[model samples]
Target chain A: MTLLQVAAFTSDFPDDMVEDEHDIIQFGGKGVSEAIGAILSGLGYSVGELDYQGERGWEFSAGAEGQQIWLLLSDLGDYLMLQVEDPSFMGLRPKYRQFREHFLSGLTDALNRDGRFHDLLWFAAVGDPFGFPDPAGEGGRRPAPQAWRWS
Target chain B: MASPPLQSRARVVTKSYRPMRGIEVVGPLARPEYESPSDIAAKARSAAAAYVDRHPEHRSKAMMAANIAGAGAGVVRGGYHMAKGLVDAAAFVQRAANPLPDVLLGRKTAGQQTIDLAGAIGDYVIEGRADPSRLGRDAKQAVANAKADLFPSATPVAANTADELARRFSIGMNQGELGANVASLAVGGPLAKAVGKAGEVMALQRFPAARYIAQGYSPEAAAYLAEPYSGMGSHWVPRRTKPPSWFVDSDYNVLKPRGITRGEMYELHARVDPKFSTARLPPRFADRSWRFEKSGLRRHGPLAQVWHGMPGATKAKGGGSLAAFGSGAHQLGEEGYQ
Candidate 1:
């Protein structure tokens, strides 16, 4: 069996948006929250929040559809970043592409509709869950692409 | 018969005697001696096990003692950091929950102190004068946010004092209206926005590319190069909102008021234009793909797990280095570039 792979990337939130809890059309706009919600709904994944256990700050997460899609809202309050969960990549390549599309493209479509988040620079990289080593290694992260393109 | 009686008298003889010497005793669980059997090591282990069986309480007591001793030593060695983390946590909650007590006590929270220190340093770095917003955080308005958050009953006490002195000092205006203060901060929000325009205007002029970033321009788009701000400043908030590109995603500098971030330092150094130089750069800057985070910057990728986790001297070193990089980035952009 091959290593289970997951799509992972970092997104930046400008300073005004980083710590915002309230204010619409302003920093921490309602649009940002709605965009995330929309992405979950469109992808057919349930809404979730990270427990953080003994740690500080809020880190929300949701991985549903039998692990077809998953996401973790960054815990660090200073910067807003996102992590998609590890889905088993032992399946066919088309299945892998479908999982990747659900979030990145789903998010892009949502942002286009709301027109709030812009240039949401998503990048490419894959990792194995359960710490399985990858065969390709450093050669996998090539410099040719800066951001991920979606349909 | 006569000869036999003489012989019996001569038969009595005396014998000298000495007591056996005591063997020197050794300490418990130390060297031991056993019978002629060869497996003394195994026998000794069994004997030790038997002793514990007889004194089960001693085993537990010994374990408790060892654990306590280890914890005490840990506290002694790393206690200062532990103590600070605890204090910061308390202040963090208290300041968030109800800052009045902290302010009345004349104590500034860690974040505020960090902001002030950054401003003090900026005096030497940011065009000779630190931005006032960065230098002095107004204490009163900040304190007012907690009224409904922690103790909603204190709503009557929260108010807005329009006087400049209270706004500047964030002191003594502890007696204000919550609704009014929130309102004033909003409609009069222009007041907060108005103070730093000149310095910010200078910053914007120094780099118009900021406008593109502000508008969420795609670097992939042909027009990504920064343009002069023909657009009005009314809605476009700059510099304060987003950071420039050179910043590592995980290494937040208190001086710059940005967050922490990534990279294999050697990997990042390879990407930078050799002619465009800066000091104290992490060998690599975190590309967008690096994502997972714990206490520090983490990629959690198959390979991108380089985060500077230790916080004391190492984090301080990061803060100082990042501060220098802030200046270096400004220099590279402003004084002409290749």
Candidate 2:
């Protein structure tokens, strides 16, 4: 089992703040998710409108080429279940899907622009397994997802 | 000529090349206008001093800030690179279109796992996460993601090791500088090790070179030796020593001593060794003297030599030697030697 954890603060926070904690927008809060979604769209990953199921979480899937990415967003943050045609290559991460999506999409964009033939072929998958669950499905925290920003 | 009076073992030592004739000249061949040690030192020092005098406090602060900013930029760049690598690796797996997904599902080898992980790490470095101490939970988690991206057993042993070490060394380094330094070292270290290992791998394949080079050598060496050198573009030699000096350092005596002043030494050092020149502060006065040892000054090539004169140099350039060096530095850069 592999575990990764991350703590982050929102970027470009407003300079003028005189109110409470809720007004400031903590890192893992709602504003962050919206920002993450926008960044994802900017990177070419289309996120379907999310639907909340009871108290469990929100579910949605983004698709590109032949792959479909299923994600879950809850109070904890976002979760991503990445799937390709290959059954063995399935990947799941908790509460960092926003970063993961952005990272993958940004990478694809960069590679395409870097000289498509060699660059695209060079980076097509996660180089190493980021996190995996144990037989009991109870392992350490999964790695926080990452995002790429060109500007 | 009377063979240049070479009578002292203490001064001149035997060497393969002919003695440097230009060293004995009173004035620099590059700068015919300036003619003495005092002249060169004064010119360089005054130029440097002017700038120093103007910004009594901001100079050092600016330098430190620039260095830190540079380091931070490196880290950001590295992080971005790693993120891009992850995408590539994921794409590679998808394109393989392999039917053995079930067969290889969780049994991936260390090599299989690390290739993409390396890329992800590259992104981390590029994105300005270079400083280990400054890494937030998000950065740590990003590093941990390598385990899932690469290893089937989900082991992040290698990635974690690399991340931890990089972080430790870069604790206080600027994010960019830290990232760049770590990235260079990381990339270079692996390349060096691989190159070392390749020589051995080629030798084991029973290649032709194995006959002599691999004699009594280990398996690794033999393998690398066996491979033909044709495909290997260029041999990369590890940097084992300081880079060669790109400037010439020569000293001259002051026929007439002048009043010691600030920035005079810096100007001289800048003239002669601009490539590696810097002014050193003295116990009595931070800026004084012609030699780097005395003034604690250094200059990059060409500039260092240019800054090697005295009184005339200081007086001609105006009151501030610091600004003189900074202002004409670009020109010195143009005529710099290797």
- Provide the overall lDDT of each model, using Cα atoms, as 2-decimal numbers: 0.31, 0.32
- Residues A62-93 of candidate 1 have per-residue lDDT tens digits of 44544444443332222233444444352346
Which ten residues in a row are the worst by lDDT in model 2 chain B? B231-240
The per-residue C-alpha lDDT of model 1 at residue B228 equals: 18
- What's the CA error at residue B225 for candidate 1, in Å? 34
For model 2, what is the error of residue B201's alpha carbon versus the real structure, in angstroms, after optimal superposition? 44
* Tens-place lDDT digits, model 2, residues A84-129: 1111234453324444545555644543453311201111222122
TM per candidate comes to: 0.23, 0.17
Which candidate number would show the highest TM-score if scored against the true structure?
1
Across residues B1-338, which tens digit of lDDT does each residue of candidate 2 receive? Answer: 11122222112221101122223332222233212422332332233233334545634432332223223333443444445446756755664555255245554333444455577668777765566554576556655553332222343222432232223212212233233436556784344334334433432222232221212323222223333321111001101111233311111212112322222322332344211122111113221211222232233443423333333433354557645774585456434532
Best by DockQ: 1
Best by lDDT: 2
